[model samples]
Target: MTEIRWLEAFVAVAEELHFGRAALRLHTSQSPLSQTIRKLENDLGTRLFERNTRSVALTSAGHALLPRAYRVLQDMRLAREAALAEVEGVRGKILIGFSGAVNHLTLPPLTRAVRRRHPDIELDLTSRVRTRDGLASVANGTLDLAFVGVAESPDPSVVARLVAREEIGAVLPLDHPLAREKSIPLQSLAGDDFISPPTDGSSSMTEVLLASCMAAGFRPRIVQELSDPYMVLTFVAAGVGVTLMSSGISSIIPSGATYVPLDAPHHYMNHAIAWSADNDSAVLKAVLDVVEEVFPPVAS
Candidate 1:
């Protein structure tokens, strides 16, 4: 079979339309360039060019092959560039799993930082509330990392880094009587209808709120359960019922909903970055750097 060199020579001669010019462009002698073209034609079992005393012209086969050869060369160049980019940490995809609530405050800054620093990296951000599923996705190599809220310790197989502590608060309609108070006592809402996340949603904030209410000597009369924090907030704004949410969610508070800080001991929800202990992803590291920059821990 003819080598790539033969294709190059044939392409050059067919483009230049002169053996001498093609030889000069290839930095070789006319005799060798002509030989290469002849060799390519023989390999393909077809004539690619016709030569006259004064000028050279492409045969029908050469005309058909020219565009295909150019496309092949372009594709090869792009493939090489993509491989080089991956090696240089300038390209590739990273999957990030996060909670719906975190998207209200954390994702905007994180996304901007990633775009500003590593524009070539593709970020596939997914909002999921199941901590076990999120952790398993990272552990089994489906996700690069996850931003999760955990009341207890993380799985031993996963590496966890504390990102930020978001204070838990009560979300009430602005026109509600409780909105006038600077802080709402959890016990006061005992008899009122409460909106909460689904038990199966694995929301740490919901667990914290439920526990806080219990500690304060009353069980919340949960009127409805939802999965999406924004939807929960929307329901509260529409005067369906009130719910507990992270202070970070205040950033996206509905027009008619007011966020009041909890008093005394009910302060914050622990949020963290979790990934598989086996993962050594540069992209994930880049994401963590941004998170640290945006929400650095206060020293004691």
Candidate 2:
């Protein structure tokens, strides 16, 4: 019989796609981790991963098993949580995934509220660079919930609800020529190299900025892609490039960096809380309810 630990290791590796990272997540070394995978593959009679020197990828069988394995493990976890809840009312762990962009506005209040209201419930908060990865984590049961920037269109397996609409602006060096302006025209930035977030183009601020730039009559010349929103300002402050960010993200602007309002009045980004539609965890539902209560609904 395949044990829970094997599935747990498999899921971790599948989600991380790198043996080192997956081993770190599992609190083990690569040699035994590889052994665990090989053992599972032998028992199942199929390869789950295709790993070479520099890269690790999921095989087709691995892809097919990922969601199912995640679901089964999540069910087991929730079963444990449910048992605890019977005694403690609301006590268990919930893993929430979010991006660095949400630090200023969304995360602070949400985490504080959860702590105050449900102290017994444990939170394992993970911050990633892109909303796409966070949402995928939520969909695959790796994360109980995720906060992400989104468009109007929704994913079929994910239930995303708008919690806030944030005004977008440009991050510029204090001595930049445009920094003195009350509002800089997006077109004026046509020639500037942009420091953007690393995104897979599935509705990220990078893609949003690109689309906006194209509408403003130019394609932004991207010079750098930083994973941390806070660190993205480092290049900007050094006069290397400028990046567009939501107004609420001003909390992390470094000393030499300042936020300049973009000229687009109608431009805004939607901040949404997303979860897998099939998530039946009571702890997950409680967090969602808290979020909905703390924020207003999306405008029609």
Candidate 3:
């Protein structure tokens, strides 16, 4: 039964504690503002302010109503924003995924950029996803965008754009013999146990590692498989085995581990931004625009 304007007038007077100042703050005449506050007190059956010619102060009832009235105004503003966001589509929900290796390199910057520019958009980010699963998620609408590392073409229903590249390197313990080399040869690691890449079958790093090893006349013996670069490097540092990683994660190399470049015929990891061709969300379009601006597509 209470009107919003009455509450607004009450709150302004309650805060300023002066009818004339509160009227100026509300851009209304002091008498009308005072009348509105008096009406609000009558409706509530309690005095909301204690006043004299010198100054004004809050009554016990006024103190209680102040916070409640402010909250009502806040809720109304939020509700209005929610309606506007739904209509514009810029504030709609978006799911973004990334494999672990590229999450460190790309997700951080991309997440920051999107949040800064489109603060209303809901962003959901998942890390350590397999390239195959991430691509599948995009096609099915479970994901709006995915940062994947690929060695071959993705599904026909999706578009893959090369956004970044990193030369593959051997991740080895500092104490390992190969770690001291200026540039380690792929074949030299053929005998060591390896932390294989994601088994998702779409990992270009795994393909390159196996193919490079085969070209050296031997295949790597997989001792373990890890989806996270940091985890994979942890095992390497523990002497569990040596593994291949992209130079992009070199900064995250843990203590007792280091990254050494691969010699001639060096393998590289191609990081691509992939999304379904079926996606028509305006929020998705805005994200793609930012993606292209941050990491422009590389010429094929």
Candidate 4:
């Protein structure tokens, strides 16, 4: 039978890189630690370490197994905690974070679904922040989960699940000639200054927008770096510059601005739920289960 201790041992040794230190950390002796690791390697048919009297190092297979070991331990911890919380009749609180981009569409239904399913689980939603901030909070355990707008997760400790995808369009001043068209070629705005949300890893939309522009043969000259989505639109409305935005948010467009679909095909702004890989809170699992029920993740 498979045992969790084997993974725990592997992780401890992989992190410490010295069997003596790892054994000390695990409150066990070096001989037993070496035996456990050897058994693990035999079962897996791979040498996890290359060792000598002077030094010990991870083999390529060991490096590969490290992350998987962390994930397994984390999952086990979550299962155990969740089961205990249930047995103890503990009602838990979960803190949720959201980026401005996902606030309109994703949060409302998700909140309703969570409430409907896990009424005993308290959900505390944070104010609108950027995807980067939400991701950072989740990774640090300050928030349990977050709905964010990003193409990919920036941190290894944080995981992102795609929950929504929407067509992207140009946010232009109402009087801009291109705004009159039903669809605008992205390159048409090549020479125009842009008002964009911060591209400093705060939002994944910034990456999508920049990539789209580069593909269209021009780099956007951003005049402002507002972190707020509405603020970016406000600047575009005031003729500061134009920007790329999700078409689903066109309803919130300020009166002075218009959203025109980009002629580019299949490009979209993505929304994802992010959480710490190590978070073992039962409340978090409950909320995540609700997310899975209400909004199945987009197939990769």
Candidate 5:
């Protein structure tokens, strides 16, 4: 019978794609790791890896087994944690994925709450641009939760709970004429140079800004496109151009920039917390409860 030890060794080697590195991660020598992997392959009667002098890669069989093996390992880990929690009355880790913008507005408070409420629960946070990708990570058991924008409906496999909402606005140089207006009409800035966020099919802000401009009957003359909102605002403060932004971002506005709200009917953005529907960990549930208490959903 193939031992659990061999399965773990195979997984480590498959993930690292190198025997030496896999051995390092496993805290064992390369020779034993290699021997265990060979034994696993022999027991399974198939080659799991394609090895060469320069590189190592998973064979077709290995690729097919990877996801299943990962799930087994995850289940075992959860089981161990459950056993420990039963003995000590607390324990486990929750992985959180988020976007850059969400980090500024939501993550700090949520993390503080988690730390205060459940210090025994380890929290791991990662940043990513695409909310969909984050949701997928949760679905695949990679992430326990995610902080995402509520611009679109999420997948059925994931459950999203609204966290916060704020009005969208334009950021301009302090000296710009539009900065004088308390609320600027989107049409008023026609013909003005604009700096748009990059088109990565991830930033809902990009689509919202473009659509707002189109609704106002003008295609913005985009002079620059950037990935980071702070960078775009910096460019605006330098008089490079004007850019649309959310009120949550006002905290990061550069010294020379002023944020002005947009007029009625076109000025709001929603933020949400997402997690896998299948995940029912106490830590994730506790975090969700705190988020809901802090940022209740708004009716659209």
Candidate 6:
């Protein structure tokens, strides 16, 4: 059977038209180079070159085969590079999921960094996935990675790397009595009705709210549970009730609502990049490397 070295020898000699010069180009002794070419000619049943002590030239068969041989060598090089690129995590498609404020605050920089560093890798982003759903997708291999709001992933099959932790704060109607305070104690709002998002099994804003309120020795009376955070804020603005939220999302507080940081012994909501522990994807690792560079984990 034909081999790659045989093709290399043939191309080098065909191009140089001199066995000695081709051997130097190939970093091999002329004798082996000549033998390789002879083996290739014998395999093909054709004389590819005609040579005498004084000169060397390609036979008609060699002239016809030169371009084809060149293509074979070039294609082999490209094939090896493609394989290496995949092995090195520099190429492939990654499915990434994002949700809530992390979609704006954390995802952008990570996405940009991945794009810049691994331009050949394709990123397919799915937005608005909640923490639990994102975690589920990642664990099941549907999503290669997910940016979510959670101190740590509750899913045992996944690993979460903390990206950013923002202090928990309260959003109240601008006219609410506690809004007057620049910062409010968590227990101070226990008497007020609250509006919040519904809690799921995973770490979520509602979990944070309930935990913070309980830590402060009161149960928040959530009068309404809404899925859309903006709508929940709108309810707060309408004087429906107050809600606890991460300061990272404070920017979206409606005009009628005011955000006040929760007083001392600050509670924080965490954003993390989660991936399945089972997934050892090189592309995912490449993206995670960029995540580390962009948002290194901080002490929580």
Q: Global lDDT of each model?
A: 0.74, 0.83, 0.79, 0.82, 0.79, 0.81
The number of the candidate with the highest lDDT is: 2
Best by TM-score: 2
Candidate 4, 129-172: lDDT as tens digits: 67778887777565778887754556787988888888888999
Query: Which stretches of model 1 miss by more than 4 angstroms?
Result: 1-87, 151-154, 298-300
Candidate 2, residue 120: how far the Cα is off, in Å:
1.0
- After aligning candidate 3 to the native by TM-score, how far in Å is the CA of 291 from where it should be? 0.6
- lDDT per residue (tens digit) for residues 34-112 in model 6: 8999999999999998999999999999999876775565455445546878567368778898765435778888888
Clashes of each: 0, 0, 0, 0, 0, 0
lDDT of 3 by residue, 12-68 (tens): 787678899899988989998888888888888998888889989999998888767
**Predicted structure 5: clash tally:** 0
Tens-place lDDT digits, model 2, residues 223-286: 8888877778888998889988888877778889899888855477778888888878888888
For 1-300, candidate 1 gives per-residue lDDT tens digits of 247677678778876899999999889999988888887888899999888899799989989988667555434444554675666855656778887865556666777888888897788887854565676666655567777665343457787677677777889988888897989777777777888877664676677778778887888989898877788899999999988888888878879998888787775677776776655555666766777787777321
**Model 4, clash count?**
0
The TM-score of candidate 1 is 0.66
Model 3: how far residue 36 lies from native, Å: 51
TM-score of 5: 0.76
Error of 5 at 167 (Å): 0.7
Error of 5 at 179 (Å): 2.9
Model 6 residue 92 lDDT? Answer: 72
